[model samples]
Target chain A: MLYDVFISPFAEFEFMRRALIGSFALTIGAAPIGVFLMLRRMSLVGDAMAHAILPGAAVGYLISGLSLAAMTAGGLVAGCLVAILAGVVTRNTLLREDASLASFYIISLAAGVTLVSLRGSNIDLLHVLFGSVLALDDDTLLLLAWIATITLLVLAVMFRPLLLECVDPGFLRSVSRGGTVTHLVFLCLVVVNLVGGFHAMGTLLAVGMLMLPAIAARFWCAGVGPMIAAAAFIGALASISGLLVSYHAGLATGPTIILSAGVLYIFSLLVGPHGGLVRQWAPGRHLEA
Target chain B: MTFALRFSDLTLGYERHPAIHHLTGEVPAGDLLAVCGPNGAGKSTLLKGIVGILSPLDGTIERVGVGPREIAYLPQAADIDRSFPVTVYELVSTGLLREAGLFGRIGRGERTRIEDAIAAVGLTGFEGRSIGTLSGGQMQRMLFARLLLQDSPVILLDEPFTAIDDKTTSDLLGLIGRWHSEKRTVIAVLHDFEVVRKHFPRTLLLAREKVAWDATQNALNGENLLKARRMVEAFDTAAHACERAA
Candidate 1:
């Protein structure tokens, strides 16, 4: 029964194995970004950018008829455009960043749904909105792997500046010339990860893989490094359990994965050591100051 | 006297609305200059301008030997997000960024410096604690520890003693006195006239424009103090842009 629940589905189907690897890659790459997003208080901005990528993916779909390359390229462009445009408006006008991003994403989502409905059927829309785990080809797998590698390498290189930018941007700006570049590079990282993730989990559920685990990690870990590590692990666990359960029960894969992450989040909320409900209610001995 | 900073008819503001306008001045090296003014007199704006955070709208600021990185700035405590998840050690260590550069290794020597700086600021026992756990006084001390590690030739402090306990203030002032003795150019925006009179040697009195730039005693004179208040109260924020002779 254990083997049937765990190993049989992956052993029986090449698609299941591909899905597993693809999601593992996505979690490894996207989860750290998720931690930073929460730290920077940009969780909703990440969500807005996720929606902002939709119209671009829709445009790509309309042009190339389900071509991965076209959709990814389109999504990347659209997400970056929205990010840059929102930034520009925030700097040039009285509108704040959250306000600008909200307006642009709302418009992008409407435009994307309209564009998808204009030419395609509901099935195509479902594929775009809620992604197909069964459809990850070798090229898509390579893309995910490459994206994960690049994310890790770039994050390592920019870790110091990025941390400074998050905690004390004014200090970073005064001390070094890398502050603006660090910010732009970070935004690019968000866009690239979202683009890669949208291939497997769809834009809607993709951010769940990014955000839910990160949020859960906050309750478990105190430091940024451990929080990121914890988040990645939680995301990978969710991906695996969700994939196995979906296979056994004939359920949709993407939402199942996100729901699995949601479960972990709720669990962390209840029992995590840092600030969980359990810890809060059950008082511990005070430390000698 | 060798000048550390020279402002040539400087105007600093947000969106072309000048907060401090047509100001011209020079700061001699190793001068402990206090910037005293009424509220909204652009005291913080002037410090920001000197630190290169805000560019001059009308003129230039020539630094003698100090580069942009050579200026250490301590903004108001309210400006920092204390709730951020960082240890005092980690935050204090970042002061070495000028020497470390991006991705540079923090070797044994740097680590020792960080510890010493923390100890100097009376935050040795609190090194491992998160910044959020610190009280306002401890937070200020931590920032001073960071400033110590910064070790810049020019130090700018903005309202450093506000809401701080007297003990912490005195302790921090001792450190500032050490900086002055070490010949670092120290410029601070201070509100307390007594503190200014007692500690600061020189003072620049301002109210959107310069009222007096002289020794602390002269700058804090009753007439100049009253003039600064009147000037600050008389200014109209909604008034049109100043039209003046070139």
Candidate 2:
């Protein structure tokens, strides 16, 4: 029975396998970007960027009649551009960064909803926000694989500048030309990952997945390289565990994966090495002598 | 001897408000310069301006021959943005980014230099320790190690003595003196007039809108000294009034 429900089910149907593959692909793609986003304090932007894509997704559907990959692509490009433009406006104008982000995101969210409403009755706007993991198709799996590969490559190539800029913007500026431009590019890369993640993980889960592992891994160490590795491991593990839980319990895979990540975050909060509650609460572990 | 820093009519500030007006100064080779001022007198602002932290408003302020490759800056103790997850070793190693003299991999010679720099700052055993796990003095030492790795001919320090114990202060000043003996120029924005007289041969007093005074304590003993005293008293009175209002 266990073989039939768990092991043999993979052999019987393609959708179940596709669902797992799609989610894994998405995780691999978005995990590293998620880690860095948390470091940059750009996690909220990641979440907002994910939501920012919904109206674009709806608009793409109305134009293309529900080609998931094409619609998602449209949504991603629109969201990324909006994020960049908002950042630019914030820097150029008198408004503070977060305030500008709030202004742009609110308007984008409103516009996206209006676009979705105008698109037609066939499309469900809720599906864009929550994501439809069960509806994973071959094309989406391929797209996920492609995005994951691109993200890995981009990070590898620009690792030095990106990491340096994140850690020491002034230092990078002192060394490199137009350090601000380099920072913007990094932000854009993070936005791309979030938009790509929206395909299988959905907006909320996608953003949650980005931050949870990184924050949890802060309990492990204070080194950037190690922190990122730990975060990626936690993310991959949470994805697998979440998928398994959903497979067994008939729950929403995206939300379940998010819950798994949430568990890790909580664990890190209480048991993390840097500032864990357990360490603080232990008899001999308190900071003061 | 090369001019370590030569500022010609440099005007610098934040946003639109100018702090150090179109002023000029030169710190020749191997000299220890004490930049003095009352509260809000733009001493720190002048140091930052020299290091290109704040953009120059008008006129030319050149570091003479020093490019980005040749200057090390030790920021104010309170001004450091320290929310990073880095170790002392990591912080020092960043200094070698300019010093390594190459790319891709850091060579053995650079690594040896980094170790020596860390040792010089009395943080030999703490190189592997996380920066967040440091005391205020240790953090300053770690920053000094970073500056050492930069190995620049010119070092600009902004109020590096605040909150430090006197022992550490002397230890650090001794190190700065050693650099001067090695023919490296050190320019520091300082508050201690006593130390200024003892260690620094030349001192420049600033009052935001003016140079205020630029000479030794002997010059300060004359009319220049009385004017500087007035400036200092003005600053004290302003602080007391603000406190009462608060």
lDDT of each: 0.89, 0.72
Q: Candidate 1's residue-wise lDDT over B1-246, tens digit each?
A: 999999888889887888898889899999999999998898999988888888888888899888866799998654556767899999999998888877789999999999999999998889899988998899899999999999999999999999998999999999999999999999999999898899999999999989999999999999999999886444566888678643
lDDT score for candidate 2 against the true structure: 0.72
- Per DockQ, the best of the predicted structures is 1
Clashing residue pairs for model 1: none
TM-score of 1: 0.96
In model 2, how large is the Cα lDDT of residue A181?
70
lDDT of 2 by residue, A89-134 (tens): 8767788667877777777779877776675575665566777777
TM-score of chain A, model 1?
Answer: 0.94
Off by over 4 Å in 2: A1-6, A89-95, A117-122, A164-178, A268-274, A283-289, B68-70, B77-83, B99-103, B209-215, B229-246
- Evaluate fnat for each of the predicted models and list the values in order: 0.53, 0.15
